[model samples]
Target: MKPSFFSQYWCMVSQGWKADLADKERLITPLLFAITVLLLFNFCFEEVSKGIEGQVFTAELYLTTLFALQMSYVRIFVPDQQDKVFSLLQSYPLNYSAWFLSKYTLALLYSLLVFVPVMLLCGLFFSGADLNIWSAELWLGGLLSIIGLSTLGILLSTLTLKASGREMLFPLLYFPLAVPVLLASVQASLSFLTSVPGGWHWMGILAGFDIIYFTLGVLLFGELVTAV
Candidate 1:
């Protein structure tokens, strides 16, 4: 009999964690890239007002998260893809939903690690932005947006897995699909400064995107992985 879904999921996550441990650089790269992008944004607009700064940084945070997720998605299946191990794994009677969940979980963890610290840093530098960084709405919006981004990331990563010029192809596919989610993230965050009700609406949109992308991933990942 096949392992239970939880059993399969834990096993995949454990292996993924081990791979991350072995390649420390892979784990660090996205965090470093996010910070670098935020730093550049700071330098470019050093004289902007607190309100404008709040909006700019809020937008930057999600944009950085999106780019960082792209970096991570590239490696989501690297371990199994290497050495024909993917084929061996596919031969087993595994649960594909569990497989999708594990990859999504890994990507979500990486995105939070990359996003939260940078978000705190932005709060520190632009405290006058009047957007309460610690607000529940802001955090919820960030979480929902990251969920949507990770969902798209995994699906696109697999879609381009065997294609030529994947590095170039991924961004072409990712950015277009990710734009609406990223926009909702930024709006959800910025709305906190203007109107509480508006913030919730944006968060709802973010959640809707997450649901759509996640459903697509669960349905398509099995076929995408097994395709010739």
Candidate 2:
């Protein structure tokens, strides 16, 4: 008899988590990429920084995470495919929602660790930017934004699961789909930085984006992973 759906979900999560532990080097790509993006943005927007009332640093924090997470996420499923373990999984009665959430969790954890501290440092030190970088609201909003972005990334990943040019196709599919997350994240971060009145509204919108994608993932992941 087949395992229960919840049991299959847990099994897939454990499998994915253990696999990631053994291949710890894969974690480096997102971390390094995130740092590089933050630095590059800080430099690229140096002139713009002078005009954004130093909210530039906050912009760097969230916007850079937005793009960097998407860029690094294309590789989230590559290792599974390269080893052909997903083929092995196909033999089991596994739910693709499990697969989706497991991948999303790992990617989000790495992105949070790398982006949050650097963003905090910038928020504290960047001149003219007045933000309570230590506030729970900011952290929570950042977390929600990452979650929203990861949800969209996983959805795109599933769509491109078999595409030959996934690297080229992913961004093409991802950026347009992810615009809501991107926009709400920027607005939420800007509100946090400037103490504006409408931050929660954008946060709520980010959370809504997360909910929509997550629901779609649960509903559609089965067909997505099963497609030829």
Candidate 3:
């Protein structure tokens, strides 16, 4: 029996995600870096926790989430451009939007995989740390933030494909574009960590950013890929 279009698309996405995970060096590097960042923050806040009583731990978690999202952007886009695989992917019959969405979804999933475990470790290390607020809104906000950052990274990667200094170009172009995501994500995370009311506003911003960038990425990716 022939696979339906959605099935075929999902299969392609799953394959892409597996390929990313199978790259041991690339995959392990980010995981290690994330772990190290968490550890460093834990140590730095060890003494400070006495004064703030948990806000330090909360800030550390928030920073980890932000850093994890940023790293995922580089991981998702840079390697594809460096290896010239994205150009090759253009030869396939896959829908451009589907292809883009697949990449974004994979990055989101990978980010969560790395994030949750590291967060758990953080909780274990910091006695006062709380992971109780793992609600639907927090997860949705994180996913949306990942989607926005991933789209921006993909867009910048496309722009830098032919440039002489893609290494330098990527961070310069990517970080500034990601400021809003970082801000909104941090706000949402703080609200979650503190159990504060009215944090969903930042989540709404994240969703808005995702929708805007997803539309723009879909519209522009076809032209960009064709140009390559």
The Cα local distance difference test for each model comes to 0.84, 0.73, 0.69
TM-score of each: 0.95, 0.87, 0.79
Model 1: CA > 4 A from native: none
In candidate 3, position 9 carries an lDDT of 64
lDDT of 2 at 175: 79
Candidate 1 per-residue lDDT over residues 121-178, each given as its tens digit: 7887677666678888788888898889999999998899889998999999999999
Backbone clashes in model 2, listed as residue pairs: none
Clash pairs, candidate 1, are none
State the weakest 10-residue window (summed lDDT) of model 2: 45-54
Choose 1 or 3, whichever is better by TM-score: 1
Better of 1 and 2 by lDDT: 1
Winner on TM-score (2 vs 3):
2
Highest lDDT, which number?
Answer: 1
TM-score of 2: 0.87
What overall lDDT, based on C-alpha atoms, would model 3 receive against the true structure?
0.69
